[model samples]
Target chain A: MSCAKPLSWETLVDWWAADLDEAGTSSVEEHLLGCDVCSAVARRVAATAEALRSMVPPVVRPEQLAEMFRRGVRILENPIAPGQTCDFHFPKNADLAVHVLGGLALAPGASVEVTLRSLASGTVLGHVEDAPFDAQRGAVYLACQRDYAQLDHDLVAEVRVGKDRPAARYTILHHW
Target chain B: MLSASDTVVPSRWYRLGSMMTEATDSALLAAIAAGGAGRREAERALCRRYAPRIRLYGLRHLRDEDRGRDLVQTVLLGVLEASREGRVREPEQLVRFVLGTCRNAVLRLRELEGRAQPATDEVLVAAAGGEAPRDPVNAAVLLRCLGSLGDRARRVLELSFHEELESEEVATRLALSRGNVRVIRHRALAALRACLDAPARGAA
Candidate 1:
């Protein structure tokens, strides 16, 4: 059997994986009948693509969103131990409002910084530093403005242990 | 004039032009330009339309859901600020701008953590696919084939397929003409098909 061109075996595999139409299927059938190397490459690519498609993570939940907000509020209200990081998840379309409560473990005169960043574009939405931290009642009150609400990206709130490293990172969904 | 069934299908470019007409981005841009009530409505529409896609894109890049969401919010605000300043004129431009920003953000995070090789292709493949191939040898071959694509082509494929953007939207955001976008997309798809079908041809 004569082939039109000596298409590389690798190229053929790429074509087969991408092609879903009749022409592509027929071409593959013809190639398989005439070439052994191409057939193996095709099978491998298909299997791998299939395997990769299955690993996407499931969606976030409301409870996770509430917890993430609560944790962010906590970190902003109290000082966290250096090197300790918290991860909080946000559910889609949940309110962005958060309330901080006072806790006895927080130290007096400790300041909190709330930095909101986008996970998609890695942009900083808002960064408020030296926000008053009241250790007395173990609570600080702060409101997430709608200014950050227009974003279509996922948000990450990083509460630094001090001025250096993060004490906790909370994910919040911005819904307008 | 032709009957509906007999009429030639509109070209991708034509479809894209029409899509652009109703695009939320365009409306947002107009609202931003107009200011006031129109601006508020456009901004809201922008948030509704792009937020989920942005979140998903962020998740894919950052591998952390919370971080991705935060990034989406920040990018949107930045876009709004730029719009307010008359810096951005087109909604399609926002997509590229956001993705470019995302790339930078991920790089910064990696640097801050001092982690070399942020994440492996295997991890992305796994994240994209799920459970590692039951057969390691076959998986390795597949990875090699995907790696063969040039970075630009790979990115185009991801933006078109993974991001689920229409061809015209992809073209507009990428600043390419619609025809060019279709061609590139076609070539990329062809490449993927070739890579997958190579084994069968070899066997022949």
Candidate 2:
């Protein structure tokens, strides 16, 4: 309760809450252990800190996120050209989510659908809704949610449309 | 469309590391403010450093790894977007901005999850030290003490501890005189101690 700088228990509380450096924090801890008033203050401060932290949710790793950004940039730079078909294999452990950004030219009536079919059992996961293709900067954003946590199976994405038959297939390598 | 020119990777990625290493925080802020390639590079670097922390913070709050990861990604993306839009003014304010955004995101997630009570206090205490005191009764009493403080005092305390803001900044932002801030902060602490000391306070 009594300090040189007219400091109060709140100051100690604040110090404890803020995760201050060792020196300041240690001093605050010392005070809390010795002074009943400060100890009480520390308890409240600690509680408040806990409450605030709980209110916030957890977030993902930076490396994984950086990879996602890199993928986005890659898609923007080199999309599937009109006549070229590229096949990508989703690993059994990977749940891929693709986003297709429609280009300017595919405005009127050009449509594209990406179907994911299991090669072994011919089981269909689902079809991704695609917009009309544009000449300027059309893109198909594709994301596959593979149940890697469950079964290990190779899934192929079949690109189907009228007249343009540039088909590509990828083998899913299941890790888990 | 698939020519070599289109395939050529931008030289910006190679330059990014050096720029990040050499640039001051202010310089990075300036580059971000300028927008274009420089902004992208700056954002990438920022994401690299702070994203992990954000994820860890999120994990502590959400208690779900996948959800936490999503929140981290969302927070970084939001920060990048804000930077692109010229909403962020100072580089030093980045932590505050990220933390505030994370707080809001968690609140929304809680609403979606239908969990009313937020465990921020418990999270903070655990984060502060590896081991909390073994006495649950005392811990509960302490929490009650914190609840007794007024909103402003609580805010100041939370900001000071959780966000690690300096007292001077807290006073300035809260528009309170430094002396008054100090006094209120002190009183709040004292009141908490009194509450903790009272018999059966934890039960209450």
Candidate 3:
């Protein structure tokens, strides 16, 4: 598989398209990395592949991650119901706000408690006690400060309503 | 709709938010293989850099957009996982590594689908080699070259490459023999390559 001499056009094309086995591909790639002539051919083959790809309509839609981003923006537009669980999915290190729709119904003077936990390991990634709640807007808020590394897996945001009410859970779905 | 130039880059590709834009593939792979906080960032950067091309390769072979999407995720995830385990080597030959993984992904897909025959990966074989054509043939020059081709030849290329139809289907649709279809395509591509390699019209 060591391409001593320049590889044939067919072999280069195969290399470009990854048609060769590991050893053959490695040989061709090693040569292309150092050989100007072969590298130039590899570039051209890539260009042709790019051209052919243009002819085909996109089978896969654009990343939904962008849409999720916009959703973060629109989350404020619609108020979460009193008991509605707001689901937020985003990558780590994102400056995201947990939107609890319709706000929570707190006891006489009980404050809202928001906690971000890893669903996989049951680790508490972030916590906020007696979090600032807008009673007029019936909403509670917490800043999502978990490390992106912590977000490599699934996560959940739990809101505790005092000591007796059911907690509203928001599943964090991140695509990165 | 289809105005001449046939290059299709994935949309919004520049928004990958990579911090290692200046890092070489070797460096990125090294970081990935080293295993640390930087590994995740490097893996993300590498995936962003190559996912579009890998997806395009899948689309061409699998002929289904969803399957193509699957190929992209599968291959990239495999690379990240493999690199973590010290399975990937020779980071300098990064392109080949990605391509090799892509081929394996396609073959696996083919097997899963129970395709009776092996998929041919040489559709562009005829365009290979020869005094390495201009690294990236000028778009205007390429369009002019494609425009200069005879109608039937152009149509043949359109049907074959653009439409991605099989040779038999292209022949049936164009009312030409399969051999005739291939000849026209080969000749047309040659002409395009020559035009691309030639100096711009006003060059000294």
Candidate 4:
């Protein structure tokens, strides 16, 4: 059964601190949006939480914060070029695989050039001259055998689908 | 509000790349003012640079971790919206603009909470007025008080906040009864509050 009672201040603080499960958090958020009394309590609790957090500044690292920002920005910044989109999932015990997504219209065996470049300097880091499309996935894979330790900088993959098609650039953010 | 799962393609990666290098505060501001992909990239770069600081502000004022994150989103979006709408007069003074936004955000939060005045610690240091009360708590004093707590108390706080573990999980790990865990957490926070709000150690 769902909790009918107003959540205690401690529970509210815990929710605010993200010390709750996803379901608990969602329920609390939904309740807070509607309950004025709880909202007021949360504001005060938030002040206390802030004080405690400020006292412990190192709780969240700079890189973690940057990564969160990067993720949030990804939501705001739309991909300008037209192509299929796919998420990057690194598999253990496999070569570094960069999936360059292309439009669904791209047929199987469609030739493409995948050029990886440094985001900061625009210097070419690697290139695959003739990677064919996996039409099922509508993407091209650029497998790199270099030591993973050597790939730490933010990069962009410029994928030219065909001779006349516009090159679609994909951001490859390096997460630590 | 594009979910990463929904749109995996790069919308503004090139701009993100170029903006990473040689973009001054003014140049970033200009990019934000230009709108579209330029604006999005600038927003990303700015968030990456300032979100931590803003989160700290949220923690100090809002006193909640989730609220601190919300504060980052609120402040950044507000600043970007203001910039995009051509409201920022001094594009070069981006730092000042951000500080002002933060101040306004804190002040607005107070208003929302029905507080007619700023919280004691939130007294505007730059305001021209009578003596502002010393903040009830300072980081150094709080840290010192935190260290004074027993190891168990410290661990509970760490596990609860840093590890983001539930009380039940924390109890399981610590081998304490769930009820005892709650008691310890309550007593620990109370002790900390009392210590932090206490008068300076040697004030005559």
Give the winner by TM-score: 3
Whole-structure CA lDDT of model 4: 0.56
Report the Cα lDDT for candidate 3. Answer: 0.55
Those runs of model 2 whose alpha carbons end farther than 4 Å from true positions after fitting are A1-176, B1-13, B114-204
Query: Comparing only chain A of model 3 with the true chain A, what is the TM-score?
Result: 0.40
* TM-score of predicted structure 4: 0.31
In the range A58-111, model 3's lDDT, one tens digit per residue, is 111112223445756322222355433444454334443344434566544566
Worst-scoring 10-residue span by lDDT in model 4 chain A: A73-82
Cα deviation of A170 in candidate 2 (Å)? 51
Kindly list the per-residue Cα lDDT of model 4 for residues B36-78, writing each as its tens digit: 7666666666555555555544554565555555556666777
Over the stretch B1-204, how does candidate 1's per-residue lDDT look in tens digits? 786655445664455445543555655676667787456545655554445444444444454545555555655665666776777755556666555555566676556653223233231222323221123323323333444666556555655654556657777777887566656665665676566557443223
DockQ of 1: 0.02
Where in model 4 is the C-alpha error above 4 Å? A1-6, A17-24, A35-37, A54-176, B1-137, B163-169, B199-204
Ranking under DockQ, best-scoring first? 2, 3, 4, 1
Q: Write the per-residue lDDT of candidate 1 for residues A44-116, one digit (tens) a residue.
A: 4433333333211111123443455675532222223323332323334433434342232456556666565
True contacts kept of 1: 0.01
- For candidate 2, lDDT tens digit of each residue in B66-180? 5665566666666767876778766666666766777788787777874333333332223223322212333234434555667687666655544557677878988997667
Runs in model 3 deviating more than 4 A are A1-176, B1-19, B114-149, B158-183, B186-204
lDDT of 2 at A117: 64
Model 1, stretches more than 4 Å misplaced?
A1-176, B1-24, B89-92, B113-204
lDDT for model 2: 0.50
What is each predicted model's overall lDDT from 0 to 1? 0.48, 0.50, 0.55, 0.56
